[model samples]
Target chain A: MTLVLESQLPLLIVMLTLGTVAKVRTVGSGGEPGALSRLGPAVLVPGRMQAPALLVCAAGELVLAAGLLVSTHPFFRWGTVAFFAMSTYVLLELRRRRPDAGCGCFGEVSSAPVGWRSIGRTVALTGLAAVSVWSPVTGWAAAAGWVIAGPPPWYAAAGVALLALLSPEIEELIDRVRYRAPCEQRHGPAESVTLSKLRSSGTWRAHHQDLVSAEPYDSWRELCWRFFAFRNHEDDDVVFAVYLSGRRPAVRMAVVSREGSDSLPDYIPVSA
Target chain B: MGHPSVERRRVLAAAVLGRTGAVPGADPGDEEPLRAVVGEVLDVSPHLITIETPGGVQERLVIAPWATAWNGSDTTPGDLSVGSMVLMRTLRDGRVVERIWADTTRITGTILSITGKKDLTVELDCGPHRGHRSVVIPYRASGRLQVRHPQFEPGYLFDAIGIRRDGASLALLPATSQPPYPARSVPPPPPAYAGTLSRIAGTATWSDTFDEEERGAAYPMLERTDTGCPKTGVSCAGLPYLAVGSLLQVRNVCSNRSANVPVVACGCMAGRFCDRCVECDTSPRGRIAELSPSSYVELGGELIKGCFNAQIGLG
Candidate 1:
């Protein structure tokens, strides 16, 4: 097969290999995507586990990329280092206490990380590729392709992989713009009550007001909020979490009509 | 932020014969002067009381309008009226009598802007000079030293006296505490569109047409308004267009400090939720209120500095 065809076909085989891994979800977080348990399921998939798949894929990638090098085309060779580096980084992230679970590498295909076994697989496969590099026939062919393809395959693959790593941050920011605050609100007739609205209002304040109130937050974080409901045995009281820049001196409420201005100001939390 | 300051100030004040250093003792001298636990009032006109000193003599003497008496309740003393039982200085033809805490700060606002007709568009932050973020002393008969003073534009800083503190801000001092700064030397043109925080340091005398029909006094522009907003979103009485905690975007006319602020509570009368607090603390306002306008307010950036309208990058 042609270098491109070999490389392309192996990518599919790798996908097929990974597809066999059973996806698992941790029971604790419900279905909330907290972190790496995302990849846990797929890694623990009964049949075509991650390590084997990565092994096949990396091996395929190495062979195809080497073939490309033999054709004196160094453009795709760097993919070798990139694939391995990404595999390693993902493994590390998965092992973290706060695992970065969103390891969606296959685009709309899957988000599971290739797993720990991937290390051994990569090591074995890379060694094979290295061994092949010394063969007289293989050497000459690889040399011819490398000389013709500009630099070596490592440069191209490494560059492409590096680009892949950073693109997510840019993409994430772009996605955030879509969730802008619903401005110019007509207020929807000002609903008096609702569970959805109630929670949303408080959630919004807790997010945004967290910044205003000594709490650690910024206004943007509180996009929507719900009113907090405090129930007494007799009546349902709604108390606004009044925002103030107060120190824990005391909680006294008093009003002072400041000088030079017509504004009547009140300070809460004093010698009550 | 208090106690000592209150003590020193009280010590600097006329001596009291009966009361202890503050801890509820008799003011020091004489027949323990007269002490009454009456309801808080506005003005103690026609009569006043004298605070006794340890030396059996009354000294420094407080002015009636200058003192404030509090009512033992959750209610604010601002609700008290001149007819309310206020602690005051009994004076005979402005002579010494007694010093009592009256029911008022008597000073407010740091003047942010000034208008013609002696009306001062000030930033109401606290008592006395609390909200007057800028000083607009009546420099000339023609009002040359008013809001649009030639030598006192947005960037020009001037010295002013008689400023006081308010909630979490400062106001213009009385004609007394004026600190010194310079005028623009040349006339400063008013900003194109000013925000509430951009008010000049002079007094504003606006006649509300609403008051012409609803209330009698112009209510000092925003002297007093209802706190609990009508849930119907239909404004009729003295309530604001928006309720407390409602989000608002304020733009400083001069420096353009614009940001979305969650309505903490209502400012005296600035439109919308003009407060911008990063924390829910009462002390900042108390401290800021004690500062004089000339001592605290800067002529640059948002005329009012401590509001959350400043946190979201407005200042």
Candidate 2:
């Protein structure tokens, strides 16, 4: 059990942090943003209890996992007790909101085609968490386990948990958010009113030259960009947007205007 | 019994089952949306606003609470406050205004494109209906790109910049002002700009931190990676990953709803694919009925939902 916990340590820590972070940002955000955002809150039932309950359950697992990894007998038992106690809290919360929702105690852990014995282990572990808290002896065992293992194990666990993915990965995503498209429900339905396509290409004196000289990129890709040129009376002036996917394009930005519609300007400026 | 879009395969998922399996995370545009001034309302259950375009077209829009609704209000449409302006994705929802935020949410447009060497050149495209139009964005901006593209040609009119709104409007929490990118005027593109066209392939990497107010606007991107799933049958490599506090498109494998969330937790595989999530075995159906204040993402395909961080592809 300890070895297993140790191996899956990174994932477990990430999960707990994720849970906490998820609850924190939206904790007080009120109802979920929409049907989409509501998915997290909907399950395990709704109300304040769900987030806290999940938090406790995960935290308990985190603590228990930490103890087991160290192989500290005393701390292990105590940690087990704490984990069960926490799980009990989670299950209680779940029961309050949704009794039918099976205890998702071991997410992906229990999903993979495992053996009957594994199921038994899961049942036992869940009982430890969902049924009741641990006894005094178990608590003592966890405490002792922590002693033998020392602070190093605890610190290591903490450190590993904090760093889930590389930093560079976060920097790689460039979201190009466009609104007022002809249809939000329709995919690939962006309204791109080009100069030539708009008959407005005649006034193309080049307003976005700044972006042209921004830099000499090594690569780029056309994620998605288009100027909205709906009705001449439309209020949207969305110029084309180019997110550096792989390489830089020759004309990075373009204005969306009708053939003769100057309701705005022939071209706007691009700032690097 | 089932959705026609699903059976007809007209939806984006038609490709989901394709050879390459249409990649899941694809962002639409670059600048914040300009739309019908859906007049604002106070504390509407789902936060509604009336968007009135210059043409006097009044369309209704649903929005999230400002300040996280960490604070709520009950002001009526008649009590329109100064704190309302929506930064939205320029996509319409059936005629009902549908970008994330259309009211009071300020938005900016950042332009990026490919250069000769196959690297990405990003430019800041900003301002209202008139600020930008004549010129194309240059290849200069602060940030990095993924692997260089193969086609090292030039003169490619790749794409534009815009914003996606989470609600109809958002406020500058007095403590913080507006986003960093200010509107700038620029000269026209060199005539040769069109002559430098080329085919490029790579990724865009926007830098950010916690104070990343613009993270919601530009930091998150959909990656076009050719890399397949890991042989072990797992990969978050290609989903749309968001920066901290940015909205994430998390698709639940069990239920079909793709939850759009903030980047509370980082360090995952770019938040591309979530390998772990806290789930309840509750019936997705029952939960759906109970789940109120929802936004429907009408994709070109069917709806797939679940708890948070749901993955869309097959194992």
Candidate 3:
């Protein structure tokens, strides 16, 4: 029970810090539009209920943080478990729905995407809460007193908690450092006006459903190109290539028939 | 978000991305007559040189009669020999070599002084030449050079493209600014001023009116008023508080660049910006003002490089 209380002390501190950050960020700027927009798909929180839901979530975190600090009862431990479970569920759902959306789990400014690292952190916290629930409550109270009474020890514990909370961000930073390419090799121009115009065209809009999954062509050619893999109305998977040609910039579409198996032909002009 | 901290974080992220080369628009010319090829010289002659490209292909190129070659400072075709490394640019014809640099000395730096519009000096912070260098922009070359910003104020950084003329001098050449392809449509004017009229500190972005292709008339040009007097200022019909001809001061907080500009025309045309000013506002997210390309450049901002964090004050 003593060992369990000791371990849980650091976890509680980390959770308390994270909860405070989440609460402040949620209530910050009136509300975080980027986070709110992503909430609907991740948590089933509807657009109309986003404001109220955010308030409730933020307030709940604050209450939980305060409760954990003063009490060691089974109720608070169970509450920690429940809170961590909900967080893990939300993060997993976010990872599944919109892998590109920032977690907004820690703070509004953190643009880190929800990934296995976030899930792992949540799982670790939930495990700590579950373990602490089984331990006796008497030692937990004494440990909290020690953490508050001793300044040096409290500083050490706070440092450890901060490091634990920042572990995921550090991992992400390492990943970026390992995977990013050199500047000279990766630099390039922005999206061309021709591609922008093609995207805005009526024909492209009409077929946007099909072209949404298109991949841009990677070559330096006279024309800009993109390929789409989409299902037609008949539910048959069709592959086609779209080209933006001419100095004036015009669009031309070509369907690659499986039966024909012919290579790409010369540009077939299509009016915008 | 409305929070100033959030906006600052977003701007800081953009600045970091720009430094990492993650942001696009660094490439000056997507479409130009000159084609660059880097390779090792296998055989050399006065008129022709054979070299192997990195792609493992052997190619022969014709040397132009007036082709200028620079090894470190300046060199002639006679200096080229076997096993020499070179980066060469040739005309689209593939036969006429325009310029070749054996060891190029590129400079990215902040302008320290300007003698006039034709000759400005810069203090190089990056590249092999890491010191002050005088850049001579000839009158003929000025029209074609794609300077990131219009106003050559001290402390504005510029990525210079030219060959080394001497240890402390680089002869400036006109870098390409045209997009790979011409713009298909003219971008509509900026959006209506829906926000309140106050000292708004937000990101600043730029747009240009030097349309060599001549797609549309230059924006915010002077026009004769109904009262028969010449009027020049951005139209501000939608913004009743910020009336037309109102003077506004825009400052780039990051580079310490500032300019006092007048409202020539309203951001909105009939009712809205061409496309909500999405096409014109090149600044990062949470942009506040859209300056004319010249105005943006004059305020020490880059159109292609995207947005710079700025503070807009109503003067």
Candidate 4:
């Protein structure tokens, strides 16, 4: 088991190096300024210290990568474990705060939100780092020797490098395949009576001022339903369930009152 | 060793499937029925013509005796010669040239003048006829031209794909241009939200052509169109960054009207919209999100007003 896990060190080293380069480039380009700014708050850095915080983050990534590559000492191995543990924490916090925000972990190349896949990847890296602590190989020299004199030839290094380069793309592809709806299986027609149609309705015009926000209620169903929240216009919070249904394409709207409870069933249905 | 009858059946099956005797599993149906190749004629003979494609690949194709040829207008095969830029359509065999249009001229230049609201006087700055040469683009021919400009004006660059007519003038056909629409200025997005939601403010407008036309061009990755997104697809030359399928919450800045409209088209200056008059700027700021006419009317804005100021937000 140790030999099998130790054999993966070359691939992990390549992936970490590639990730470090990507982070350095992203910091230089300021591609995800929003994500970078949020990082300042996540790590308890001052808001005004965004630039220095980003530099520190980049430098830390470089150090982690260098330490993983050049040293097999318990300090470097433990440092790797701590570094990935910190990364996993920061990513989870960012995910909790801004679920829609780009992870910016691999830079501008990926826009995937920090989700289970990212956390899973970090956990895997942490496990790998822990394994590296017990392994005899230390530094690029030993790893290179392993590749040259080991069972596999130098061509295996090229394959590992190629796989490392494609890691971000593979992650993005996994996200797309997992989350994106297939074309044929889409819920409904591309265009439905959305807020535009609601505003066009006579009932909507009369109650326009009481409007608050239009939130999509359900996406899994064949028809996408949106809940339009409105303030108390006639002494009650108005909730409008607007969606397109039936064969002959028409906008269906139902008004309800939010008297108590946050559930949809708690709202009392009212006619428009 | 197979039986004689089995061997005969196999041979019969191969023949029925249109497989060549020399190559097993090769399907004759794999050959395209009709395909086009554009190149400059290097050599021409009664039986064949050798041409060099734009990619520097030289190909020699056989010309069928019954092949039809046109150079701007209908012409005999005898008229085809060296140095002619030809667009050739070949049959399934690939060797037989079926139809060929030779010396088809394509020009990219700025409009020098407009005559009678139809005819255009263009100064050729690129293509075969370079160096400020004036060419008259007739009104009758302009109708066939696929122009995307918001307005026709001088100083706007155009790409005219047509044939050179009599007297060195170009009979313009399908064409595209980069119209000059002032880029709509967009305000900087708001600071990152501590929560899971973020919002920004922008204006909204409407159009009636949403359902009838293909909106896939605006968001090429999201929507797929059969007729080539950038060419025969809808104009997304308004806001290049806004994808077609994105949903936005819009609230009227002046009135109490608000709605959620999915972007069905891109109004950015691209493709056909690129042909608008030179007055419109093609910058990335001051962008407009167009809506369906019904959407506009529903948003409590008059149709005649064309556009209304509204705060648009994306989560």
Candidate 5:
């Protein structure tokens, strides 16, 4: 029983360290505001005091985690138990006061609403911390022993399984991975890419010398091709239609005379 | 179904399959007949075609009866030589090809140097990864090309779509639109607003270039003389005088989520692209901010959708 209680110390220390780091990191304006401001005590705390309150909570958890890791003293162990008990109470209050807000237990990753799973996880954590209060091993000591030994006791595995089951963040992470933008919504190849393709065609090479200017004064897209118009030496409108797709898209050019006569330019076969 | 890793693997596998099996174009000019499958032609016939992917996989496709092939102009598939690179479009079933293009590629980037008089051999900086490619602009195309590309000097952007011949890209036709100035001489943005504009409404796009996880953004413009702006401002489109490391209060109108992100990079490319985002409604033209993927996702942006209707304020 004492060995199982000792095992709980390492788990409690890990949870506290993770929670503390997450809270501290997210208290900044640039970080995920939903991680702290939209959950936990932030829901109930005054607007001006929210960030400071989050920092204070994180500081308390850090101190308790450090104490639990280094010492097997009754003071540190009991402090962890009381911390988790208070967290459970806070989660319950969060659910009642702001049902839409999350527990915010794990920063932005924990933006799920307060529910039975969240409360149950806190209750289990409090129970685990309470059990550790009677143990004679520090979290570091127990962790070192587990590393040297083959594996942790079965109760440690049970604790991990229970916590994993209650973590709503897992589902959210999975949903993120599963999400894919619809085909039409996904970013298309940039205009630069299309322009690159237009420059690489045979028709451009054939009619290259006829244009008075290198820059197309006007360009527009219609269906599968983009049209570019430049003035020829004769002041004629040299218009080129470049197919937008294919390994070798069709490139065709016609010189529009000043009188609006569209005629294909003199075809000059080029060596490839 | 609830296993995180399992679900992730499944979704990733689906994404990969969707990419490999079929890719319909999403752009305005990317119609069904224009959808391309790029590979080296292994075998070609009036009825059947076989191509080898860059990955060495052999893809055997059926050629539609009315399919047309273009080498320089209209040509028969039988004329395309084996081992020649080709781009083809498929029918609805994605197995029957309707159009095939051959021996085409593009040369675009800053002109490093120009050599020769009758037929110029141009050295081009094709971005960072491609390094440099030597393109020869034939004497016939030089006059018109020179007219459109007035600077024609080093540091000017050169773009042309032409054919691959003799192990080099030939400059055939210029790109549809050209940036008038030299690559290094991007004009400064309009002068700073006369008065403080508290809330500027625009679009927010995302880029993974500068640390995907960093909570920062690339603003379109900053004061040209300011020490914080290392690059020349490309467009006179957005709020001016915003410098690097300045905090911006960005809010996504569609999601109603907001975040304060710092300016980390210059969004010169975004400035040049005068476009609107229709995420919720038509956003005003011009990209105000290009956010890191992390910041974008945190503010309820879908990475694949590309942009969001955004409003920003100085923080």
Candidate 6:
């Protein structure tokens, strides 16, 4: 039973490390508000401070993970148990109050709203951490002690099975593997897909008024992009290329001069 | 892939800011090149290079000894990265490349607001993906821009062709004629032809929204109750009722080329533009079919030029 309890320490360390990396990466590259904003505790933090708060949480997880890997001290064990216990409580509150938001245990991948499976995983992690509070050896020591073992103890197998059953992210991994074909090679998107993406792009809206006719004069696809051309008010060709993949397909535009030259005269800046 | 060097970025920044000494002269070619090829670079060699054009055709062009390549600024052809988008100008031979612009970027959107007293700064709403961006209209170009864009207010649309510096887009040249009206006031299109016909005579276009090898057409008109169709009203008047898998016998009036293609995707977008095609002669001002790139080429349509006067019937 001691060995089984120690074995769970590595699992906690790994989960903590993953969470730390994901959170830190999200905070480092600033863009849209991350999954942290959707978590229940977000209401307590200002929008500008959300990233910093996520970084702080990640720092705590890293410290706990590093502490558990090298030391079997009661303090480290108890801290880990407390961390997961707090996590379980937070997830429960999120589920009850903001059912539409995720616990944000991971980063963007955890943006899938609070679910029974996520809460179950947190609860199971808390139980695992509680059992590891009595471990006598560090996570690294327990891992080293498993040299050519006949089989893991029944409890280790049971713990792994429970964690697997509670992890809904596994289905996404399976789907990715099942449909691994490149975007262009797959049965391409519908015409409406490219058109809608083009319409939503900044390039389209900017040049929309200059178009001579209401509809695109010509359009064609090449690889992962669909190109649409329209004559501008100046009779020059205004062409747009919409990327055929991703949630927001990238759109590009080029205006060919009526004389067919690729170059447009430079704009000479002067006081307005 | 390797990115444009910092020195090149600085040069592009200077060029965009209208400080012109760092900018290089245009590619050493005729004033008017026959074609401008836009595509992603696939393969490159010292003497030869290949690119997948927007029409999905892999074009192999001879890299002229004098061919100039620019990413953010003047660069060597060897420095061009695979998978980077490029705009190339070919010499008269139509096979030898004379110029290449790599990773060229463009910005088009509505002017949300304007700031700055000397060098005017314009904030643009570049739609959802790009969100908002701020561009500097260099003092040198401000006068010319204001003359062209008279109503440079918040509601009017703005456009510029430029390059990306770091992660931000820098607007270099006006990409299109600026309309004086608000973007929301685009003139309504003439009503689409609503009547049905057995043989539709109109412009046929191509879209790359399908496998390159697949031969098919996306008919603008469909049976009202067809599964997989969004149940939108018929897109064009001349189109006959067609199903998803129906066959279309298409002929290009200009080339006299013909083929039978299947209906593989939707052409709801094509129905919106009621405009004529003057490829050979004037085609009726409504799109009848949107063909896959391969099928479009097979029916003697040049993908870059965009359309062909087409006649189609149920096959």
Q: Pick the candidate with the highest TM-score.
A: 6
lDDT of 4 by residue, A70-143 (tens): 77767777887887777778778777877765556565544555667667666666766676667776557656
- Compared with the true structure, all predictions reach lDDT values of 0.28, 0.28, 0.46, 0.48, 0.66, 0.64
Q: What's the i-RMS for candidate 3 in angstroms?
A: 22.7
Candidate 5 docking DockQ: 0.01
Model 6 bad stretches (over 4 Å): A27-44, A148-150, A180-272, B1-315
Model 3, B206-246: lDDT tens digits are 32212211111111222222112222222322122232333
Best by lDDT: 5
lDDT of 3 at A241: 33
lDDT of 2 at A151: 42
Candidate 2 lDDT score at position A240: 34
Better of 5 and 6 by lDDT: 5
Model 6 Cα lDDT, one tens digit per residue, B138-184: 67667766775777889777765555555555555554346554554
Provide the lowest-lDDT 10-residue window in model 1 chain A.
Answer: A215-224
Residue-level lDDT tens digits of model 1 in A1-272? 13322222222223323323212112222221222234432343333354344344434554654454354333333444455455555555555632434343332123433344344444433333333332333334444555676655553344334433533433444443544223211122122232223233433333333222322111100112211223222321212222211221121111212132232222222231
Q: List the candidate 3 regions with Cα displacement exceeding 4 Å.
A: A31-35, A39-43, A138-272, B1-261, B264-315
What TM-score against the true fold does each predicted structure earn? 0.22, 0.24, 0.33, 0.31, 0.36, 0.37
Clash number for each model: 154, 143, 15, 31, 22, 13
Which segments of model 2 are wrong by more than 4 Å? A1-46, A66-73, A81-97, A100-121, A124-207, A210-238, A243-252, A255-272, B1-315
DockQ of each: 0.02, 0.01, 0.01, 0.01, 0.01, 0.01
What is the two-chain DockQ of model 2?
A: 0.01
- List TM-score (chain A only) for every prediction: 0.24, 0.34, 0.50, 0.51, 0.64, 0.63
lDDT of 1 by residue, B1-315 (tens): 112122122211111111122222212232223322212332333344333332344433333444333332223333434433233333343244333322222323333444544534333223221234432333332243233234333333332222122332122322221212221121111222212222112111111111111111111111121232211221111121333323333322233322232233223322111111232221111010111111111111111222211111111
| DockQ-derived CAPRI band for the predicted complex in model 3 | incorrect
Residue range A28-99, candidate 6, lDDT tens digits: 654323335664445347767777777888889999999999997888788887888887888778778777
Native-vs-model 4 lDDT?
0.48
TM-score of 3: 0.33
Q: Give the residue spans of candidate 1 off by over 4 A.
A: A1-272, B1-315
